[model samples]
Target: MLQSFYLILCILGFVLPYSQFVPFLLEHGLDIKLFFEQLFANRISGFFGMDVAVSSLVLWTFVFWEGTRLKMRYLWVYVVCNLLVGVSFGLPLFLLIRQRQVEQQTD
Candidate 1:
């Protein structure tokens, strides 16, 4: 289900930071300073923006999923915590999960 998908995505997120991409960069003798500068100057904004979007989606999905199992009070707390997690990790998946739950209720 969505939960499983979320977990898998989280695992991938963790793995990506140290995966072949980093090794490939290192192998190419890329300069860390220049590379970082380029990343920040040209890519970090877009990259992190995507991260935020994705995190929001996942978070809202999780919230909605959890709402199905619990009372509103608990669900609200769950949503707040999920939002905090998303903010901390720059991921929107959790927020997205919650938004889905709200949409379900309204439907």
Candidate 2:
């Protein structure tokens, strides 16, 4: 049940953000300056952007520390997911994988 939830979240995470971003990409064609300008265009957006930035750093740290402790391979997968999507995809994906590994160890 939990894994299913995480999988759903992963799909939603990838889809929802790209839903917004893909159109931007289509219209702008990799406008980095415009992207940042719009991202921090207002106080609320800036707040969210900063928060996500900090959260991504924290997520990366957690992925490294906990994943290494559990001896999980392919730690890069989560990071790549994060880079491609966002923390929404990466964190739950990591949690789902971690849960399976824990269950395996107990079994």
Candidate 3:
């Protein structure tokens, strides 16, 4: 049940963010300067940008520590996903994998 929940979250995470991002990509075609300009266009946007930046760091740290402790392979995959998408995509995906690993260990 938890695994199923996590899977659902992962799907939502990827889809929800990409729903916003894909349009930008289609319109701008990887305009890094414009991206940053818009990302921090105002205080509110800057707040979100900073929040995500810090959250990404936290996620990376947790992924490294817990994943290594559990001897989980493909740790870099989570980091890459986080970079390409966001914490929304990375966190639940990591949790899903971590859940499976835990289940296997217990079994």
lDDT of each: 0.54, 0.93, 0.98
Whose TM-score is higher: candidate 2's or candidate 3's?
3
In candidate 2, which residue ranges exceed 4 Å CA deviation? none
Sort by lDDT, best first: 3, 2, 1
For model 3, what is the error of residue 6's alpha carbon versus the real structure, in angstroms, after optimal superposition? Answer: 0.7
Instruction: Residues 2-78, candidate 3: write the lDDT tens digits.
Output: 99999999999999999998999999999999999999999999999999999999999999999999999999999
Q: What's the TM-score of each model vs. the native? A: 0.33, 0.96, 0.98
lDDT of 1 by residue, 17-98 (tens): 4473477577766576754555467576659757766866766665566655633345455446444343333233443455
lDDT of 2: 0.93
Clashes in predicted model 2: 0
Q: Model 3 off-target regions past 4 Å?
A: none
Model 2 over residues 1-98: C-alpha lDDT tens digits?
88899889888888899999999999999999999999999999999999999999999999999999999999999999998889988999999999
What is the lDDT for 90 in model 2? 94
Poorest stretch of ten by lDDT in candidate 1: 84-93
